[model samples]
Target: MARASDVFTEGDADLKVLEVKSWLKSRGVRDFEPVSLFADQLTKDTVAAIEKLADTCTANKSSSAIKKAIVKGIPRQAVLKPSHAVYRLQNQRFALGDRVTMVQDSGGVPLSVKGVVIGLNTKSIDVVWDVPFMSGVTIGDRCSEYRGSTVEFDSCLNLTNPQFVASTNPKAPATSIPNTPFKPRSGPYPAVRPAPGHIGASGFRPAPARFVVSSLDLINSVL
Candidate 1:
């Protein structure tokens, strides 16, 4: 079984696949082993093609060359559909309808303005601020009629943002109950009452009983 540290992210999967295959080949047992032996394989052919494409781009370094590389690199299963892509910053992830707040002031929007995520892509998230004033809709534009703003992942923090300490809420003031009288109980039961009998080996009795009668009791008493 693999530990959490042994796991690889999407960016590292291709390279790890290549390394695993190379190691297997070095051991001289390639004919029986299929590519499916490793999970998350982009396939050896796909890795080779990507390497070729990268080399071509590095050599040419022109707009036309880059465009040609992208054209050749398109996935074989490509289809037109509404993208449900998720974006990440640090350990926090952004998706549609996730609540977020601005950490820095930009354009007309002020810091700590709460907003809902309406859109997201690889680089940034589009938030619709709850404020009445217009906010910037793009990266560097002044202001737009839109209620929210577009900000880079680093510019805003999400509800579960990992950058700050988890114990504190930035919006709320810290409070303490000064000089509290409450304390934890020592034990589950109340203090034990003294037993009705005498103490061990001690000849002491608590007291002798004494009685006094009132006049009314005397009048009703038998002679």
Candidate 2:
């Protein structure tokens, strides 16, 4: 029995074509060796088929699949609306610190976020959360008594507005009155008093006695 060497190995089983050819060429054995597995002669067709199969089997093996390049650009109508609520809430009727659950609807699902009534408005109770978008609605829940297990503060005015400080005891300081226009016109004014015992200076006139008048008449007669 002719045992199967690598040069004449098997039928339908592929061999390292280069190894066999190189070994044969090195040994100068150009003539074919006898087949052992199926007793078929090594022909050009079989060799060519083997080479073609080897070429097909050799391919790129990659760890990841090749991805196509995508071109990206911003759309013309893209806009960022206000996504989160921006007000803190408190209820005037509720005590200062009471826990209230936030609700998606007026009485809908009680949200996970809780709210301490930080503030309240006539319409809505404000809340804050690590979250921003509420059910993807641009206008959030504006109903009274937010339902949630978590809470947040939104408006700066709620905590800092004058309404929060309405109970302040300090009254507004009184406005100082501006100085008068004349500002107390004062200095030494003229004194208009007459002599202490004298009557009216314009009404005084001296009267002559009757004897003085007669003596004046006799002197004139003697003359």
Candidate 3:
């Protein structure tokens, strides 16, 4: 008859030494010296020794039950270290001008606040939110506008949940303001001759007045 340890070794191929230690600790199995000594290579003899030790710890539980307990003691993937989380965030390459959404009240109710990535540090990111802080604001207030202000990554939302919107460049055509007229030229090599009244004594035309559009106006137009 195959022993319970043999069944476990064949069935759970991914089992590790740490998991064995965790399982022993969870069950208060104090006689762990033999198991710990041969943790790297848990042969049939080692497993039999461990089974004997486990029997002394819990008289009522069967070897199969001990196997189940060990399986249950496996650490979850989500239980990550702080440094690992930060390393993951750093690998994302979140740069300035990247648009990101901050998720608030994620557990009970989710609220997504839009912001632009303005700065980055070793430990956190700096975001300029499209809205200001307000009292009693909830998920329903996502569309509500406020005076734009900056916030730290940790303060605004969990670093793990920052949803990427779009990365932008100041010189990118998509981000450039529209409806700004081009200035005419007046020199001998001018691309386009200046209009009759706009010509200067130096034979160069002055640049046209730039029409700056407010961000609020842009948003309102889209709506």
In terms of lDDT, which candidate is strongest?
1
**Candidate 2 lDDT over residue span 48-142, tens digit each:** 34334433443443447657786455332221122222321232223222334342332332344333332233334333222233332211222
User: Per-residue CA lDDT of candidate 3, range 1-223, in tens?
Assistant: 6545664665553465458768988998864433222112223343334334434544665666644333343233323333343332222444455566554343221246655454344444444444445531222221223323333343342343343222233343332222332122222354454577666446655688999999999999999
Error of 2 at 166 (Å): 36
Kindly provide the TM-score of model 2 when superposed on the true structure, using C-alpha atoms. 0.16
Kindly report which residue pairs in candidate 1 clash with one another: none
Give lDDT tens digits, candidate 1, residues 96-207: 5566776654446676777666545545666656543554453222222445466666566667533333223444543322233212223323335346663434444457
- For candidate 3, which ten residues in a row score worst on lDDT? 135-144
Residue 157: error of model 2 in Å?
24
- Best of the two (2, 3) by lDDT: 3
- What C-alpha lDDT values do all the predictions have? 0.49, 0.34, 0.42
